[model samples]
Target: MKVIAFGASTSSTSINKALATYTAGLVDGAEVKVLNISDYSVPMFSEDLEKEIGQAEGAQAFLRDLADADALVISYAEHNGHYPAAFKNLFDWATRIDREVFKNKPAVYLSTSPGPGGAQSVLAAAVGSAPFFAGNVKASLSVPNFYDVFDLEAGQVKDDAVNAQLKEAVAKLA
Candidate 1:
């Protein structure tokens, strides 16, 4: 399987990015491609901007990446209980190019945060919106208290329960 994983964040030290990368790596025998939201920078979407610029090369490339994937692993970072502006902007641009942005690709969705809520609000939002964009969500996982559960240097989940849940979720990808 060609698996594409990304954190819906632009932060240099995004816990969600680490989680996505770790989870994607767990899918046995799959070729994984990790994307950084900052690398696909598109001008913030607006009708006026669309009129001024027909389409952005960055957005086109981003969509092409999604199109090439057989499966997707996305971990969203919540900012103020919502998606970060960087991700939302890229999403908006991609959607304009094609309504079915996810291309019906099976996906494992995940989220994490420093707090107990574990960015669940944003995960819920993604779950609710994904179908419209043809995201075939197979499983979802949320890791609460990210700092306590994940070991950044080791690149693994330290909490047994969370680790088990993540394993089950990644299994669905296979």
Candidate 2:
């Protein structure tokens, strides 16, 4: 099976990006393609802009990524209890192309942060809003106190309890 996974961020040193990459490896028997949001940059969504230049190549590429995916994995990085600006911009551009860009693909929704909440607010928001894009909800994993549970240097989960739950979630989605 093929799975398209991304951090929902563009930062080179993003913790959410790390979480997403680690989560992708948990899926059994799938090829995961990680996306770089920088590569899918679109101008701020505005009706004026849309009329001026039509959809940008970045928007089309973003839509194409979703179109080609069988399943998706995303680990959101919350900024003020919402999606990061980079991800929000990409989402806006993609939805401008089509509101249902995800096309009902099964998803392993996730979030992570340095705090204990693990971007729960944003993760919950994604769960609520994702269906509009035809996200077929499969599993959601929130990594709380990420610094304590995850080994950044080793790129693995150090907490056994968290790791076990992660395995269960991945199995359900996979």
Candidate 3:
């Protein structure tokens, strides 16, 4: 199966991106494509901006990437208990191009943060909103205290229980 994974953040060193990449690797036999949102940048969405610049090639490409995927593994980064501007902007542009931006593909949603809440607010928002855009969410996970639970050197979850839960969640993609 073709799996497209991305972190909903623009940070070059985004922990959510790391988590998405690692989780995508765990899906056995699936061809994975890890996308960086920064690579798909677009001007902040507005009716005026759309009228001035027209559709952006980058946004179209980003939508094409989602359209090509059979499954998705997305990890959300929270900014003040909500989605960062980078992700929100991309979503807005993609939504204009296609209302069902996720294309009804089964997805695994994940979130991690430096704090104990693990970006749960944004994760909840994603789960709640994804289906409206045709995101067939199959499972969701929240890894709290990201630095403590994730091992940067090892590029994996360090906590055994969290790792097991992550594995179980990814397995549902099949």
Candidate 4:
């Protein structure tokens, strides 16, 4: 499968990105391309910015990525129990260009956090509405207490249970 994966967070050292990448690795014969939203720099979603900038080069490129992708793996970062402002802006910008960037494409929804809640709120928010926006939402997972379950330097999950569940989710999605 041609998988387009991305972390919803724009942080330079995003654990969510690591989780998405790790999940991509679990799929055999899958071609994975991970994206960083910060590189896109979509101007804060406002009609004013849209009219003035007419969409950033990055957003257009992102749309193209979605068009070519067979599947999407998104690991949403929780910002106060919601999507990061940057990712929300990107989603808004994408909708402006293509009402269905997803277009029923299979999606593996995921989230992770250092907190015990493990980005549950953000994942729920996305899974709840992503289908309305053309996502064939697949299995979901949230790694809780991220530091305890994932090793940043290794870029891998530490707990056996977490890894097992994640592997299962990836296999099902693939």
Candidate 5:
């Protein structure tokens, strides 16, 4: 399967990015394409901007990437218990181009943070609103206390239990 994976944040050193990419790699025999949401930068969406620019190339390109994917893996980074502005902006623009931005592809949503809450609020929001955006959610996982559970240098999950749970979640796609 061609799995399109991305962290919904623009941070250069986003832990959510690491988690998303690493989790995507767990799918056996799958080709993973990692997307940097920052690369698909669109101006903050607004009716005025929509009228001025018609459509943003970044949003179009972002949609094209999703269109080619057989499945999706998105890890969200939370800011004040909500989506980071960078991600929300691109997402808003993409929605304008195609309300079904996920293209009805099966998806696994994930979130992580340095705290025990694990960014669950945003994950819940994503999962809750997924159907409206045509997201075919297969499963979801939240990895809390990221620095403790994941080994940055090894680029792998260190906790055996979390690793097992992660495997179980990804298995839904197969």
Candidate 6:
């Protein structure tokens, strides 16, 4: 399987990005492509901007990447209990080009945070609304207290129970 993975955040040191890349690596025998959303930067979305620049190249390119994927693993970073502004802006532009940005690919949604909330608010929203955007959600997980469960130096999940759950969730893609 060709799995495309990304963390929906623009932070250079985004923990969500690390989590997404690590989770994508769990898919046995799959070729994984991890994207850095900051690389596909687009100016904030607006009707006026859309009228001025039709479809932004960044959005189109991002959508094309999604089109090429057999499946996706996305980890969302929550800001004020919702999506980060950068991701939401890119998504808005992508939707203008292709409403089905996920391109009907099966997807696994993930989220995490240093706090106990686990960024569940955004994860739940992503999983819940995925179908409307042609995201075939196979499974979803929210890892709470990211710093505790993830070992930055080891570059993997350290908590056994969370690791097991992540493995199980990713396995559903098969």
Model 6 / residue 77 / CA error / Å = 0.3
Residue-by-residue lDDT tens digits, candidate 6, 44-82: 899998999899999989998888888899999999999
Query: Mind giving the per-residue lDDT tens digits that candidate 1 earns over 1-174?
Result: 999999999999999999999999888899999999899979879999998998877889999998889899999999999999988998898889898999888899999999999999999999999989998999998888999999999999888998888888988976
Question: What would the per-residue lDDT of candidate 2 be over residues 4-92, giving only the tens digit for each residue?
Answer: 87887788988888887787788888888888778897888788998999987898998888777788888888999999887898788
Cand. 4 Cα-lDDT: 0.87
Relative to the true structure, how large is the alpha-carbon lDDT of every model?
0.92, 0.85, 0.92, 0.87, 0.93, 0.93
Q: For residues 121-160, what per-residue lDDT tens digits would candidate 4 score against the true structure?
A: 9999999998668888888988889999888888888899
Please provide TM-scores, in order, for all candidate models, with all chains considered together: 0.97, 0.95, 0.97, 0.94, 0.98, 0.98
List where candidate 4 sits over 4 angstroms from the true fold.
Answer: none
- In terms of lDDT, the poorest run of 10 residues in model 5 is 165-174
Q: What is the lDDT of residue 5 in candidate 1?
A: 94
Q: Of the pair 1 and 4, which is ahead by lDDT?
A: 1
Comparison by TM-score, 4 against 6, better one? 6
Runs in model 1 with CA error above 4 Å?
none
Model 5 steric clash pairs: none
How do these models rank on TM-score, best leading? 5, 6, 1, 3, 2, 4
Q: Which stretches of candidate 6 lie over 4 Å from their true place?
A: none
Question: Given candidate 1, what's the lDDT at residue 3?
Answer: 91
Q: What does each candidate score in C-alpha RMSD?
A: 0.8, 1.1, 0.9, 1.3, 0.6, 0.7
User: For model 3, how does the per-residue alpha-carbon lDDT over 16-115 read when each residue is reduced to its tens digit?
Assistant: 9999999998899999999999999798899898888888777899999988899999999999999999889988988888889998898999999998
- Candidate number with the higher lDDT (2 or 6): 6
- Model 5 segments beyond 4 Å from truth? none
Q: Which parts of model 2 have CA positions greater than 4 angstroms off?
A: none
What is candidate 4's CA lDDT for residue 51? 88
Cα error, residue 106 of model 5, in Å, equals 1.0
